[model samples]
Target: MIVFTLLGFMCATVVGIIRIRDLFSVVMLTGMFSLLGAAIYVVMDAVDVAFTEAAVGAGVSTVLMLGTLALTSREEKTTGSSRAVSGGLIALVTGVILIYGTLDMPSYGDPQSPIHNHVVPRYINQSPNEVGLPNVVTSVLASYRGYDTLGETFVIFTAAIGVIAIIGRGRRRRKKPEDQTEADT
Candidate 1:
């Protein structure tokens, strides 16, 4: 019930974002959607994912988007009807293909799931012995996929630097001419 409610809210926010021409409102709705997504992640028992979503999606991303909005128009320019129709058609087709792909996916939490049958049991049985970690999750993420995790961290750090650079450039541009002239003199 809770998951369904969160999903419904996310859907509504997405629709609102699509319909709203105001860029600020769209950003706000996107943040709300991210928060709802984080809550769903929590309910799904992915605490790490939920934390990351809340911190990055709802917090950092929202602030960065607002900073971007500060340097841009508050409303989006309207596009031609034909362009909108074509974009919508593309989105619909993509969504249909994705849904079709999911049709063959195993049901949630099936004990006999291929992953459980092969990968999970091995992790549970041998991780402590092979990886020397009592916590299976830690062993898998830190040892087995350490490079992947490091790469993800590096990407996030790089994105943060990019956002800071963009916002800093905007601030520099906003400096008064007198300030520049004074510095030059």
Candidate 2:
């Protein structure tokens, strides 16, 4: 029930994002969508995932996008209807392919699922002795998935640097005009 409500809100947000020409409004709607996704994760008992979604999706990404908006136009430029149609078609095809790919997967929480039969048990039983951690979640993330976590951190850091570079470049361009005007004076 709660999940469905969140999903509905997410759908509405997506629609709003698509219809809005204002980039700032779109960014805010995207952040709201992320918050709704985090809420869904929380309701599903994946608190760690919820925290990551909230922090990265809603917090950091929103701030970076707003920073970008600061250096650019507030409204998105209109495109041809043909281009919009082609883009929509591509998105529809991609979504269909993704859904088809998921059809073969086991249903959620099926006991006979490979992860439940194998990986989950191993992590649950061996993590304590092998990793020597009091908390299973901490051991799994910090030990077993350490490399994956590190990769995620590096990706986020790289994205942040890229945004900072773009913003800095914009500032430099703005200042060059001022510098030239001062020289003229």
Global lDDT scores for all candidate models? 0.88, 0.90
What value of lDDT does candidate 2 attain over all alpha carbons?
Answer: 0.90
- lDDT per residue (tens digit) for residues 1-185 in model 1: 88899999998999999899999999999999999999999999878789999999899889989988997778898874668878989999999999999898899767776877877888989998999977787888998889998998999899889977976677777777769899999
Candidate with top TM-score is 2
lDDT of 2 by residue, 6-123 (tens): 9999999999998999999999999999999999999988888899999999998899799889977898878746688789899999999999998999997577877678677989
Candidate 1: Cα lDDT at 76: 90
Instruction: Give all candidate RMSDs, comma-separated.
Output: 3.5, 2.6
User: CA lDDT of 62 in candidate 1?
Assistant: 97
lDDT of 1 at 136: 80
State candidate 1's TM-score.
Answer: 0.79
Q: What 10-residue stretch in candidate 1 is worst by lDDT?
A: 167-176
TM-score of 2: 0.83
